[model samples]
Target: MKKGTRTSRLTVFVVTVVAIFAMIGIFAQDVAKNTTLGLDLQGGFEIVYQISPLQEGKDLPAMSAVAESVSKRINVLGVSEPQILIEGNDRIRVQLAGVKDQEEARRVISSTANLTFRDVNDNLLSDASIIKEGGASLGYENGAPVVSLKIADQAKFAEITQKVSEMGTGNNIMIVWLDYEDGDSYVKEAAVAQAGGEAKYISAAQVKSAISGDCVISGGFTESEARELAELINSGSLPVKMTEIYSNVVSADYGIGAFNKTATAGIVGVALVMVFMLVVYRFAGVIADVMLALYIFAVFAIYGGMGGVFTLPGIAALVLGVGMTVDANIITFERIKDELYAGRSVQNAVKEGQSTSFATIFDAQFTTLLAALIMYIFGTGAVKGFATMLMVTVFCTMVLNVYVSRFLVNQIVKSGALDNKKTWFGVKQSNIPDVAKRQEQFYFGPFKKVDFVGKAKYFITTSLIILAAAVVMICVNGFGGKGALNLGIDFSSGTKITVTSNETLNTNEVRSDFEALGYKPSRVQASGDKVVYVTLNQALEQDQLTSIKETLTAKYGIEPNDNVVTPVVGRELVKNAIALSLLAWVAMLIYITIRFKWDYAVSCIVALVHDVAIVLAIFAIFRMEINIELISVILAIIGYSINNSIVVFDRVRESVVESRKPKLTNADYKQIVNDSLDKTLVRSVFSSITTLLPIIALLLMGSGAIVTFNFAMFIGLIAGTFSSIFIAPQMWYTIRTHVKPKEKKKKKVKKEKLDELTIPGIND
Candidate 1:
């Protein structure tokens, strides 16, 4: 390379790095500000509705229509980017992230009816059952839009109105549910409002007269609103009854805690990883950190572009994403070091290392991508948010690691500044051998040789013991024993209320408060002494709900947030979680089988199961509340565990290809596994360290729910790294040993005898 050319290339590299960071600094805040924050990050509430036909077998409208209806309902709330998802066939999950007052939001969401007249206590007096078909229409009354109804039974209407009038002046109005169904009550609607925006309530002011032919009801409705109500009644378009099966409300103070703590944790965690890279890999580590900045910027930018919600789990994903992206760089740089150890020139090592390791990085990233896809498909609420962020992170990491990172590294290498430096690439001086004198098939790796394959039995036995221990703990604590896992309201049928007060709350005081209300809380936990979480054994009735709300509001001056999960929704969540896990497992298994072989796939699955079992065992022992977040954690571990297995198997396959082996013997397989482990052992360790750092930050700094999640993730990282080294490859070796290859068949030769012809026309 000419000196001038080297100078020019180095200049361009320096200029590019500065420009990338400059752009990142300028646009990062803009992107973050644009990105939406989830209810878990900002104050809001989330509800999952289980919809059914107002009348059984009546053929409810399509989920799309219901969603559209729900959208129309939320549009009135003035919430920006509210998330409404239609889940499965009969469920809709609505998330109002920035809803200031959920009272109106709730009221607008679940108020559905079929023109029923009820009292304040929601006792039904009359319904549209007596109204003649097409009796309802839009009309103007006193310069306001009103709904006109022509009654079939004027006598019945007069009697109902007279009864409503008798309730006295202040409470004389009948609670009306226009175009609503009979299954729900206004009291329940007022408290629950499980689905809102459809039901219209009219305060008749006073039923001054009994003689009424066309009853015109007005409550300051818009013409469009009155017209839709009248049209719905005339068309008899019955609104689908929505049952609030599950709801999670995060208080503003609660969300602020998560936001502040997690933001601090993520920043500190990712910074430590960057510093670790620089310290260990020297100058190359700086390059990795530079690219990592770009990677983070890209994730936020892409997610912001796609209108992805930012959540605590999403921040966790980004922090973990930094580790995984760093893993790619470690793979590439380590490959170059290995090549340099084998006496290749720095430029040759750079090109060869990238060329060989590209596929492995893709394989690792692809498997995790598969899990993210499945999670996005089958997950709800926080899991879905995590999956969304994960998918974006996956995309950014893949593109940056494959294209940008490599381009930057190659440019520097071609500039010839790092020509003969060993330590510059994180390789020791003694690692490279004398080219003329040394004559080994492969150079000894950086680490001393360890026969990981020979210890397969011990590793498997250890994992089995862990699994057995987990099972025992679960059984002893579960069902008939101690009630098994600490099931959250998400996986159990109950209500969880969060109350915030200006003074620090005593758990015993909170317990007594609930007890005074004719209920004893199953559990009472306090956060920062000001916020308290109370779990009840069952969902409260409307009156009970009202009493609790009034009581808490009077005492605390802030309404208590409640989460109610029905048994049916709980069972469905468990079922869907199991199905989602199995589906992800099967999908990854199929991919591995197509990529490698069945034995490798089996080993990978076993390792994944082992990792999950360990996590479950730890959680059970620790009594962590098992919730929907567990499903997300398990699926993520599956993706991550399989990725580790794939990387190991990739290296083994690479070694065999280099050997040009037609078939592998037991000894050959053992040698391959051990050699591959020896080569990747350092990379795996470094990868684990980088990955573990962010999660360690999570466990140290995150709040309750996230602490639990990150602890599980931390366990998974350790298990994944350990299994990739000791268990997975060892399992592969053992499987290969037991399953012998079929011997090739030998062919027999045939002899030919020559015959002579005497003449052209005669034969002998």
Candidate 2:
């Protein structure tokens, strides 16, 4: 290369680094300011409603209209930018952030707002027919509180009033009813006129003339009641009845604390990953570190741009993205190292390594993206948020870590500054073999001599034993009336009470207190310094809920926040979780088969199942809560395991394609498999370690809400690494040997013969 060209490339590299960091700095601040926080990370409440037909034999239309009605009602509570989701065929979920009056908000949302006009004979004249949409207001009628309504059809209202006026002298009256109930006559309604009844009789005015356009109804209503009635009327009536089946309320203090702790953990986790990369890969590592910074910026910028709500789990995903970025870089760098060890020129190594690793990277990222897509489709609330962030993370890692990092590293190589100094690429001069004698074998640190294939039976046997024990545990739990596993409120119908006291509370003491009250809680734990979370198997009634709250408040000097989930929602969540897992497995299998071959695809699926089973086995043995977060962890494990398997399989394919011999014996094939495993073993271990670091940090220091989630991921990462190394490749080898080995050999020979014949006339 010319000196001037070298200097130009170096200058461009310097400029690019500066520009990337500057852009990141600017976007980071923007994300912090503009991004919305979810209820779990902000003081708020969320309610899930099961919409039923108001009458028999009436089916609802997937709750879209009901969601809109509820959204309007929530807006009346002064909540800005509320989240309203229509879930499935008969449910709507509403989340309101920074709502101060929980009771008032609940009342405003569940009101029927069925306005009706009746005659003295209790005959229906009009029902929600005379009032215009969004035209009801609280006003004064002759110095008394009244609800004023704007008539949608003035002519029709006039006819009704005229008919009432024509009645006999004793019956010439019009009546107004708000949410009129059955079995309540005008006599009982008249007795409860001031405070209102189930059939709120607003007014019974004598009609002397035809009234049209706008009218006011007054019947001793207070200012607050009149205002509420007007708001409900303006919001429109819900077409179906919304029964609250699940709800969660978080206090501002808890939300702020969780956010701070999780953010701190993320910072620490990301910093450690950056330093590890810089120390391990040297110059290439520096490039990776810069790209990682940009990766973080991209995730936040895209998330904020899409108006995504940030939650605690979402933050964990961002932290996890750092680990994923490290994995991508390690895959590329390891391939480059292999090329270097094969005595390739620095420039040639960089080019070929990137080209070869691209397939593995794409396959890995796509499988993870598949899982995230399924989660987004089947998940709810914070789980959905986590899925969205995971998708964003995968996208940014591919763009920044794979392509951008490759481009930058190639520029440095082209500069020719580190031509002789292979140490900068983390390779020793003594390690590079002579070009003439180069072979497919390469050392993976101290693991070069490890016979991973020979010990496959032991690994497989061990995994089966553990899996069997897990099955037995679940079966025993089921038969013993303890349930299949320790199901959280998210997976079972239950109430979760989160109580914060003035000081740190003991978990056993809290459990004993609940037990003394004849309430055998399913689980109890003390989170952080002052919060105790308790889960009960049965849903409490309104009075029972109030009693529990009051008792806790009196004992602990603070009111407890409560969350309730019905069995209906829990059953639906479990069903969706199972469906999502199956879909992810099938999608990954199909993807791998298309990218490589069916043999590799089946083997990858087996390895994935192994990893997930191990994680579940540990969870069962420990009786950990099986919730939606565990489902996310399981999907993550699938992605991670497949990622490692693809790396090993890619190497195996490369080995067989580059072999010199026309036919391979059984021993030769075993050597090929073992060599491939040895080459990728270091990369697998290093990547898993880097990934597990952040998860460990989260487990120890992050929010207690997600500790179980992080712990599951931590175990799954180890198991995935093991399966990818020991099980997946061996399974592929066994399957390939048993299915049509002679056919492949014949095809190879026929192709060689055709190559040798090569049309004599063309050559001559």
Candidate 3:
């Protein structure tokens, strides 16, 4: 079990990887058993009911009482984990996690069982069921719209009818109750006469006086009934009469086609990166790629083990992560190449490569991690998912690039693999010659100092104005009706439709027709030119769905090839997204502060906040619609931005640690920070360029509202890079001088001048 032994270590590592994969398989089964399938993955039904607000001038307590009463009715259905909660105003959102049959789910949700009792003259009497199902119009009986009630089986309808007849005066008093199973709303009403006499059973009207005029129907309520009722009431009340806002039966054909294309894209991206590595670095790159493959195995094992849902955005994150994983190897392998080219012996080059690239790897990884942490902390829904994926990949890549790669190279060197006349990996042995024994002099490039105080007022003032306006706009819009930012159906409540025609059709034609029908669709795409997923806002009722489908059939000559679809957003899901985002940020702040110091933490937070605020401001300024995709884009940009700051900070920290012999002045340290920024500029610009391409493609070629999200990301990417270089470091200086001004001391002249040199390429 010696930690450094080669054979033993490799065996353990291999075994560990195998065990994790094994566990993942087992966990997959478990997840299949308990994991709730999202509407997209498994054909299911989701019905959202908006609980109506209280009547104008109603007391808060009364509203609470009503909500509670509604909740009780939903619980009676016995559906486990029914998501029910109050939304903005009087709206409540109810989510039934899984229901296979869409039609059946809809029937249960929209049927309002407003059981009531009425006398011959049709005088209304107390019944909560009637209130719950108030929208229904009872068919005419004896020239009056008379509501009928389904007498409970236990009540003995015949016996009750007889008893009420004997008790007397019934000129047609009818009892009404809603039957939840079939959309069969009005059952026949039984006549009722007297109150005191026990008639075995009486019309709901005759029994209205008892049970304190408020009754809870305990028996005959099915599991689905409770669930539906809960959703109806939890969501308060329907807005606009609960019309089908949107619906689409996902064509299995389109789903499968998209899956194939996505899978192909992923494979291609990975293959190209792998090929690049092999051609560029030869033996070391081969080793890196092999380890890179292993890294993929390990990362996926983690994803599966964590029950990470494979989604479109998730796929994007994975692919992006795959590309980024190569970044470290590129940096390391390039360093090794540089070492060999600079005339270092194989052993010396190997050793130097590890030591020299340590800072770069550490700096890059740490910065990226910092950004991921922020996104995971502050992002909502899909943003969180994307951030989590990025974070996991970052961690795994660090191991593969630094530790695993280092060990492999070390083993090859120790075994005299590169001692041949020609380098073991086809490199020339004569090319390896010792240059410097000391590790102190390895430099990425020349360094320069930069400061912001000279233009501090302009930057600060403009930033504040932008930030303030964003705040004001957000307050006015209130996230497009919610306190939080508006999310697309990807994270917000919504339905999705994937359609495939018998023949090929233009995607724009399909999208135009859908838009004309008022579906506000986004992410519309054609696969094989015949199938498409036209994402739409969540529809709450069957009518809304029918309306959408009718339009598609009438206009596009395409029927939903599968079943009709509706999706409901649960309160818990939204809560979790918000909570997780907040938690991630707080956790990151604490961790960073503890590892570094509170001062760094404060500066990082300021910059991060500034970055986020500016992003929000831009969104507001453009009047761009922000959705879950947009949120994810913002988070991604934030991650990139924070990495920029972290690189500068890491350099400052290293300089501080190295200068312990004779402490450098603040000015001298600033110069060190400036140099670090300059040194890493190429990497930053390159990485940013690489990252921006896909997003830019998405913006240019992607459908509908996805462009809004992409645009937000585009702005954020530029802003994040800027803030990291200008905002964070400058803020750090400002805070240090103002908050701890007394700590300032006179600096050495030369050191001070060196520190004051301007950072290259940064705008004044």
Candidate 4:
């Protein structure tokens, strides 16, 4: 390289590093401050409601109208940045974060403010029909608190008042009721001069003449009650019934503690990964570390830019992304090292390594991206947040980790800094073979003699046995009255209470207490010394939940975290989860077919299914609680497993193309497959290990909330690695070798036929 050229390359490397860090510094605080936090990370309650039509056989109310009503009601609670999303066709999810009065908030949201006015005979005169929107207010009438209403239609109100005035002297009374149900009636207010029994209503008033515009309903109500009534009146009535199907309330202290613990674990885990990379590959590792940092910053910047709400699972995704991003770097650096081992110069090695690694990197990252899309489409709440972060990380890994890392490494190599020295790039001088002596059979590292193809039958048989056992166990469980799997409250309609005490509480004692209260808990387990988890098969009402909390607080000296889900919502979630998984499978198959061959695609998808099945089987055998988080983990495993398969398949494709064979015999196919596996075995193992490290850290040291999630991923990582190395390639080889190739025809018959027909006129 020329002196000026080398200097410019060195300058480019330095500038890129400085620019990335500087941009991170500029946006870090703003991103942190602007990014939203989900209810789990922040303090608040989330409720999923199933909206039903009030009248039988009537069409369900418009979802938009229901959402608007809910939004208005939430606004009255004074919740800042409340989220109300319409889920599915007839469900709405309301999240109120950082609200002080959770119980009151729930009551207000579920209340059906159906205001109605009836005559002395209990005949309905008018309802919210004549009331103007946002026209209700609290006012005083004769030193008593009253709710004032403005009529939207003067003629309607006048007609109602005229009917009331025409009644007999003692019967000319108009009765007002809020949310009047069967067997409910208007009662007279003790403070007002009225003649009627006491009931839950605003007031009963006598009309002397027809009223036109404004009306006042005064009752013996406190200032707070009067204000609430006015607010409800202003918000109007919900058109449909809102059944609380799912709800969760997390305390602020718990959230803050979890955040701190996970954040610390993440920092430690990432630091360890960086140090390990640097130790393994010197200068190349340094470049990778820089790219990893940039990848994280970019993910955060994009997350904040998109107004994504950060959650606990999201944080896990970010930490995992840091570890997974290094895989791309590892793959590229390993390829470059292989080139150096083949006796290529540093410049040529860098160029050829990047070119060769691009397809593998693209295929792996694209499969993961497909999985994320499926997750986003089917996931909800924290699961959805996790999906979002995963997608962003995959995107950044492709762009920042792959291309940018390649650029930085090439700059360093081209600057003549790594010239003549293979050690800096993690290749030893003694290991480099003669350029002319390089052979296809040469392995990159250790385990070159391992026969992956010969052991295919053993691996396949073992996997099938395990799969068959899992199926039997699931069937037995399904018929034995428990379930096919231990479904959590998120899947089964139920209430889950997590209690923390100042002192260690016995699981038996907690179970006994719940049973004594006429509730048989399906499961009771202790988490550490202070926490106890209780699951009931039936959803709890608000009053029941309050009672349980009070009881637990009085006995255990700690308030409990509570969750509820209805059967309707649970079934919907399960249905969507299955659909999402199938969709992802089909999408990945299409992608693999387009990028590689159909045989390879089929084998990869089969491996993916094998991984998913094994993970689920493990869950069933262990009876782990299968929840929404587990669903996310399963999809992640599919993405992760296909990534490994693609890497291996990419290598195989390259080897096949490089062979320059007109027709591949079975022996040739076996050699190619085995050679590709051997060459890439080290990379695959290293990548899996690097990815598994952080997840293992999370499972061992992170918060209890994500322990199940981490465990699922951990099992999945192992299963994915196994399938990719053993099953996927073997399946592809078996399918490829079964096909017969067409033979070429010979041309010698034409000469003999011409000799025999020489006497014809055409011969002359």
The global C-alpha lDDT for each of the candidates, from Candidate 1 onward, is: 0.79, 0.82, 0.53, 0.82
Better of 3 and 4 by TM-score: 4
TM-score of 3: 0.58
| TM-score against truth, every candidate | 0.83, 0.90, 0.58, 0.90
Off by over 4 Å in 4: 141-144, 152-159, 165-170, 187-198, 206-213, 434-443, 468-472, 475-481, 740-764
The residue-level lDDT of candidate 4 at 749 comes to: 31
Count of backbone collisions within predicted model 1: 14
Off by over 4 Å in 1: 113-238, 434-443, 499-505, 525-532, 541-546, 549-560, 660-665, 741-764
Two-way lDDT contest, 1 vs 3, winner: 1
lDDT of 1 by residue, 1-764 (tens): 78899998899889889999899888878987897888887789998888888778798799998888787677656688988998888889999987876766775677553577777666777877768887878899878999888889888888888887888776676777565444655655554433654343553346655746757777678997787666556544337888877777777776877798898888888999999999889878988998888998898888889988888778888888888899989988888888877777678878889998888899899899999999898787777888888888778888887788887887888998887575798877776754445433256685447778777678778877877777777888775656778888777788988888878788888899999989989889876667788999797654576688789889987767778888887887888888988998899889998887788888898888888888888887777777777888898898876777888899976766565456667888888898898888888989989999999998887765576679889999999988898888877777778875342332233332111212323421
lDDT pick, better of 1 and 4: 4
lDDT of 4: 0.82
lDDT of 3 by residue, 104-215 (tens): 5444444443433433433443344333332322233444333322323323444333443444454433443332122222222221123333222222444322121222
Worst 10 residues of 4 by lDDT: 750-759
lDDT string, candidate 2, 307-392, tens digits: 88888788888887788878899999998898777667677788878988888888888888998888898778777888899999
Q: Which order, best to worst by lDDT? A: 2, 4, 1, 3
Off by over 4 Å in 2: 59-62, 119-121, 141-145, 152-175, 181-186, 189-213, 219-225, 433-445, 508-519, 541-543, 740-764
